[model samples]
Target: MDNTTLVDNANVVATPNGVLPLAASVELVCSSRTFVPFLFVFCAIYHFLAPLYTTPKQLSWILTTVASATMTLVSIPFVWDYVSSGGDVKSVRTLSSLTYATTRMFQAYLVSDLIMGSIYYRNQLMLLTGWFHHILYVFIVQICIKRAWTQIFCLCALMELPTFLLAISCLYPRLRSNVAFAVTFFLTRILLHLIWCISYLIPSNRTHTTGGSILPSVMLAGVFPLHAIWFKGCVKGFIKRRKENRALAPQAVTVDAVALAHATIPSSTSDSYISFRSASHNHPARKDYSLSTLHHIGYRLWPARKAIYSFVGLGRQTSS
Candidate 1:
């Protein structure tokens, strides 16, 4: 860490060698606007490339890829440095250029995901934790930055290692390693998270936790159930997708070029009927409306005469 200077009443340290001030990263990310938009653009590009995956699944995978890569990258180094340096010099206020940048990136990613996920997973979204968890995470991370709990923030980010491993397995089943995913999941989310919630038992290490004492305990303890719920969802999704692929292997895809165009029919007097946009998709299609878009439009038009086009031999099974 470099010599700390009181700049704007916030501790400022020289870059590359010293601690990077939290305010600087936040300002760089917030004021420039391009920093966060680039993240969103990255997801958009991934969505374009991953045509085989379903809408929600593509979005989910995109976020997981970026997050797991960023969080794990920053966290491993922090943990290694602290452990190797004998841990005597490390402090709660020790913010790294990489860690703060990571935290800010995470904050921006969550915010962008809230907008994008709400659109894709809006109706099917969980009131419990699907999008709400993102909101809560943004808050907790903000608190970590505000309080300068850099080390605790790094550890909390490390807990996502399990999610990332499973995500890789899902993205590429040919390279799937359930054993590695399970070990990391249990070690990080189950064991390490539980340890964080109970760290108060060790008075010496208790102070190292963010929020002094109560908040870290309460936040992660409360978050344990969420981890269980989400983990179960991920497992079910993985298994279901595997079974789907197996079933799809023997079948043949049927495609058709039917005349279809965008339309806007009035639903209510308030003019809520907007254009039902159709875009190119990977799966077989009946004209412009592919299976996925068909599903989307059907979802958009609930109960009020759903567009059920029974194209013969299309063989529809939703893929993730």
Candidate 2:
């Protein structure tokens, strides 16, 4: 019986199936194990270099830009094929040669950035979703490397392209005031991820063996809903900011109009204008004693006087 079992196992192993052989699997695992120490060393070097940046924000922006450039360059071929094939997963090519090395390097950057971000902004880092995302990503990449799922990994990495823009929006305060960043974020991070999960990952999991593709599919499935929630928040925030800007538009226009009015004052009133401006600047405290200030003070005191009268009446009634 033992001999029969051994022979059957040997036949299964020798079969020219698409699955990796045991020796190849072991080698891949060993390579992954060896690569982890290098990743740690790189992260350590990045941490030590953090002091070179003037501010934490600058360091974050620089790291994000570097990571974005690396991933964008490496995943371009995969992205092109995916798009050209009309979003067909089968059309996507696996990473190879320099591209594979670049992808690995980008992953190292992600890990290092996460570690450094946590160290520098420990409090704010806890409030961000990125901490969990980065932790999950490291595990996902390790799994993809071990299973040789380079195409799927590339698809996943492509999400970082929009993330680069998101980082840019954070770096440039002006970008945050518009809807462009939010729209791009929704399209790339939320919409693309949703499509990938529904069209590619789910279908692949259904057709492929559990050993090769299940973990990645499951991980993506678990992450998709979170992205959906984040997208909803982004939409709401965009609307809120738009409303705020609109509300402030009139106030800004009024200020501009007042400045124009002041500029158009006749030359004959130059002396009066100069005296007014000098008094306003030199005696700011005295300028607060205006009709508007008095009106506001009266409005506040009215409520207090009513409360005091009510309290005195209640006290007299209780004593009687």
Candidate 3:
């Protein structure tokens, strides 16, 4: 297809053969903003349905509610613009200043947020449905009709607010470490997204609009499953270790109690013998070394060596 036709299909006005022009290839950018509320409703419903997924507590719910309400409120103007524009690309620009820059910047944040939200909720969303969102997005982009950047960003921003809310909950001390880890891991993936944004500002890359779209799709496909697999593996390992600990804990406590009693009783008994010997003889010079002396010494020493042996299975004779 000629550059003009390709640009038209992307719903972008062609720039003078540059990266910014290619970035404009993300047509329908603000078009997706129209559907943001519906996406939020879906996420809220999804959050409730999956018990396996973590849910926000009451305080978190308040924060989520407030943030969501604000985001929804801000969309009023954009929605009005969208409705008044009648879905025409030119009409949208007529109503808005720096329409291209505004849309692409939003697109960059939205698309990256969508991919990250999918990663965050993979267990809850995919565990039962096995990645319905991934399949759905694929179908929409490849078969239903080509998606514009507007649509992608709107859907993304819709999903992101909830994920960010969840992240806020995880920032508590108990979960802060894991939250930090997830944040760091998620940031690495955004580098690719940042590239997508930068490509839009440059002109040389516009010739192959498909290249930009394909990069995100390929990255997400690989990342989503990789996250799912890693999460599943971690869950499995955790369950296995917990079961083993349950079995081992009681026995360990019993063994400790018995060992402690055995350890204390002998020392006390030995102390009594020494007291009796000293009282009866009035001095060590008059006391005879009896068979009991040898036995009592051996018994007390046995407990110490046995404790060492049980800990790491060291042989008693090793010290000898």
lDDT of 2 by residue, 24-124 (tens): 65455555765566477666665665576566665566567667756766777888988999987666766545444554665676677777777775544
Model 3, 11-91: lDDT tens per residue? 346555643344445434443553354345445544554353344342223323334444444344544544586632222
Give the TM-score (vs. native) of candidate 3.
Answer: 0.25
TM-score of each: 0.55, 0.64, 0.25
Model 2 residue 85 lDDT score: 90
**Measured by TM-score, how close is model 2 to the native structure?**
0.64
lDDT of 3: 0.41
Clashing pairs in 1: none
Q: List the residue pairs that clash in candidate 2.
A: none
Q: Regarding lDDT, does 1 or 3 come out ahead?
A: 1
Q: Which structure among the candidates has the greatest TM-score?
A: 2
Off by over 4 Å in 2: 1-53, 97-103, 172-177, 201-214, 264-320
Q: Order candidates by lDDT, high to low.
A: 1, 2, 3
